[model samples]
Target chain A: QKEVEQDPGPLSVPEGAIVSLNCTYSNSAFQYFMWYRQYSRKGPELLMYTYSSGNKEDGRFTAQVDKSSKYISLFIRDSQPSDSATYLCASAANRGSTLGRLYFGRGTQLTVWP
Target chain B: NAGVTQTPKFRILKIGQSMTLQCTQDMNHNYMYWYRQDPGMGLKLIYYSVGAGITDKGEVPNGYNVSRSTTEDFPLRLELAAPSQTSVYFCASSYSMTLKSANEKLFFGSGTQLSVL
Candidate 1:
């Protein structure tokens, strides 16, 4: 089984709605979690990052990691049309400089309608 | 800075053809990686390197090889390309600092989309 699993969602939401994207993983060794946003024809950009199991907030984006349940989530508030993109969840272990060799999710394609 | 840069934005290859997907970074990061993103799938780690001349296999390393001859270059090679190797490949780099010490965020390149038939 894949270490990380996420729904390949083409989830659509109206502007101003709150959005929640999630991923579940089977690897208990993963300690670093991150969320990335990728627009069409563009590389994935870092959105949010969290270590261990906790919540980290930056502006309208919030990242939550639950090590106990092996789940991670990204919550977007006050979604806008520009926020429409593919959201990816990634995790990694403590492997020194290769620390960012992330295990990514299939990504959730989100379209924020205006 | 260009951050991470990859050459040959797109390519197509035959079953036995060989090619190199070039990646370079200007951030002076000590860690570099190569990942493949299949359609409707997450990025899979194919190979990685820590500093110059150090390389290791990742989750999906078969049919591919990588060399980090210099601090700035990490090139992936497809010696005998197979259909399964067709996918969008990405190169990423990050600093050597630990996450707890400082943010070891990743910076990625535009990506190289390859199709092997």
Candidate 2:
């Protein structure tokens, strides 16, 4: 199985709607979870990241992780057209042979329409 | 700051032809990586370097090779291009992976789109 799996969603929503992006991993050793935003033809930039499990909120974005289920999520509030982009979920191990390596998901394409 | 820069933004090569994708970073980061993104395949690591003169293979390293001759540059070379190698290549670097701060995140280049025909 792939280390990380995410829905390649071409998810479309109206402006002001709430958007939820999620990913699941098979490796329990993954301790750091991250979410990256990529615009068309542009490389990804870190949006937010959380260590271990729990919730982290930054402005209108919230990142949540559940180590028990190996699930991670990124929620966007009051989604705007500016928020339209591809969201990628990534995870990395804190220690071990894979310390500096990051496992990424296929990414979900989001479009917030007016 | 240029962060990370990749050369030959786009290229087309005939099968069996070889080429090199250039990547340079001004951040002077110790960690550098090359990844390829295919449709719905996410990003697969091709090679990575911890510092100058040191390199290691990642998930998919069959058709590609990399060298880190300096702290600022890491180049990926494809000895024999194949149609399967056609993908968007990205070069990234990070100050560290200690998870100490959000600033220690990977910064990616604009990407090099290569088509092997």
Candidate 3:
């Protein structure tokens, strides 16, 4: 099974709508969950980050992780057309004293229509 | 800081041809990684290094090799290009995985699009 699973969504939403994106994982060892936004032909950029199972809020973006259920979510409030991009979920196991490599999900393409 | 820079933004390779994808970071990060993103697929780790002189294979490492001779440079080499190797390659770096600050984020390069024919 893939380590991380996300719907490759071409999810279209009206401007100013609240957008919720989700991902499921199979590795319980993953300790760091991250959300990245990527525009066409560009690399992924870090949008939100969370550690373990909890919720973190950053302005209009919130990241939630439920280790028990092996699920994670990213909520974007007051979405705008500029928010239209591919959202990728990534996770990594925290090494004792180092940053481990991250595993990513198939990105979901989001489009916000004005 | 030009966080991470990748060279040869795009390339087209014939079968059996070889090339190198260059990556350089000015953040003085200790961890560097190479990943490839295929169409509609998640990014797959090709190789990673925690520090200069140390390298490890990731989820997908075949048909490629990497060397970290210095802290600022990590290059991926394609010895014999194959059609299956065509993909967008990304190079990333982080200060350290153990840090707790949000700024200790993974910064990625623009990406190198490779087409192996």
TM-score of the second chain in each model?
0.95, 0.96, 0.95
**Per-prediction TM-score:** 0.94, 0.97, 0.95
C-alpha lDDT of residue B98 in model 3: 66
User: What lDDT, from 0 to 1, does candidate 3 have?
Assistant: 0.91
Better of 1 and 3 by lDDT: 3
The lDDT of each candidate is 0.88, 0.92, 0.91
Misplaced by over 4 Å in model 2 are A96-99
| Candidate 3 TM-score versus the reference | 0.95
**lDDT tens digits, residue span A1-114, model 3:** 998999998899999999999999998889888899999989999899888899999999999999999999999999999999999998888775434567899999999999
Report the CA-based lDDT of candidate 1 relative to the real structure.
Answer: 0.88
Candidate 2, residues A4-112, lDDT tens digits: the string is 9999989999999999999999999898899999998989999998988999999999999999999999999999999999999999888743425789999999999
RMSD of 1: 1.7
Residue-level error in angstroms, candidate 2, position B48: 0.6
Q: Give one digit per residue, the lDDT tens place, for model 2 in B17-72.
A: 99999999999899899999998779989998889999988989999999998999
The two-chain DockQ for each candidate, comma-separated, is 0.58, 0.64, 0.67
What is the C-alpha lDDT profile of model 1 across B1-117, one tens digit per residue?
A: 688999999999999999999999998888898999999999988998888999988889998999998999999999999999989999988886355532667788889999987
In candidate 2, which residue pairs get closer than 3 Å at backbone N, Cα or C atoms, i.e. clash? none
A-chain TM-score of every model: 0.96, 0.96, 0.95
How do the residues A7-100 of candidate 1 rate in per-residue lDDT, one tens digit apiece?
A: 9988999999999999999988888888989998778888888888999999999999989999899999999999999999988786764354
